[model samples]
Target: MEMKSAVAALAALAHEGRLNAFRLLVRAGRPGLPAGELARRLNVPPNTLSGNLTILSHAGLVEGRRAGKSVIYSARYGDMTRLLQFLMEDCCAGSSDICAPLRDVALACACEETEPS
Candidate 1:
């Protein structure tokens, strides 16, 4: 990602409400959650959630699609991965030890996933 794009994504996530909503959507995975359910879960007003989702969508962090009567929002995992890669590209000035913990966490999260049986 370019610096401008990364800045936009980071700035969008800098807000508390937007960060919380994005994290929830990330956890929800590709299928995502409906707008109403997201607002209810976050205890945020519908209008507030709408604004937050708009920012996230603009930053390429999340996307929404119409399903029936509801708009379902999901995290853009590829963008997220690219953002993370950009941040870590110059991590710790070549100190592998300093970055080990991050790699460990990523691996742990990766291992947690299982294919449908």
Candidate 2:
């Protein structure tokens, strides 16, 4: 990802509500979660959750799709991977051990290919 895009994604995640919402969506996996459900789980007001989702969508961190009467939101795994790659592009100052733990955590949370948006 370009530096600008990475910055945008990072900025979007910098907020408490947005970050929590993004993580919840990530854990929800490919099936995702409806916007109403998300708000309920997060204990956030509908309008507040909508705003957070909007920022996340603009940052390419999350995507939403219409499913009948509701919108389901899912994490954009590819964009997330690219952002992680960007952050770790210059890691450990050439010391693998220093970055090994981070790699382990990332591997633990890695997902298969995501459905196209």
Candidate 3:
């Protein structure tokens, strides 16, 4: 990702609430979660949740679709991959160990997706 795009994405996630909300959406997977459920899960006020979601969506981290009367927000995996690439683009000055933990985390996330609910 370009520097500007990476900055925007990072800035959006810099907030505690927005970071938590985005992580929750990522865990919710491609099907995503309805706004009400998301708010309830985070114990956040509806208006506050709306604001956080707005920031996340603006950063290209999340996308919302209207399902009935609710807006279901899902993580934008392509953008997420770009963010990951941007962060690790320079690695630890060529130390592969710098990315070991990240690779583990990505594997964990993938495992979660394939596991039986």
Candidate 3: which pairs clash?
none
The number of the candidate with the highest lDDT is: 1
Tens digit per residue, CA lDDT, model 1, 14-73? 999999999999899888999999999999999999999999999999999999999999
Q: Per-residue lDDT of 1-117 in model 2, one digit per residue for the tens?
A: 898999999999999999999999988998899999999999999999999999999999999999999999999988988898899999999899999999898778667755444
Q: Which regions of candidate 2 fall more than 4 Å away from where they truly are?
A: 113-117
Q: Write the per-residue lDDT of candidate 3 for residues 64-112, one digit (tens) a residue.
A: 9999999999888779888888888887777879888877887777533
- The weakest ten consecutive residues by lDDT in model 2 span 108-117
TM-scores for all candidates: the values are 0.92, 0.92, 0.87
- What TM-score does model 1 achieve against the real structure? 0.92
Order the candidates by lDDT, highest first — what do you get? Answer: 1, 2, 3
Say which prediction, candidate 1 or candidate 2, comes out ahead on lDDT.
Answer: 1
Q: Native-vs-model 1 lDDT?
A: 0.92
Over 4 Å off in model 1, which ranges?
110-117
Please list all clashing residue pairs in model 1, or write none if there are none.
none
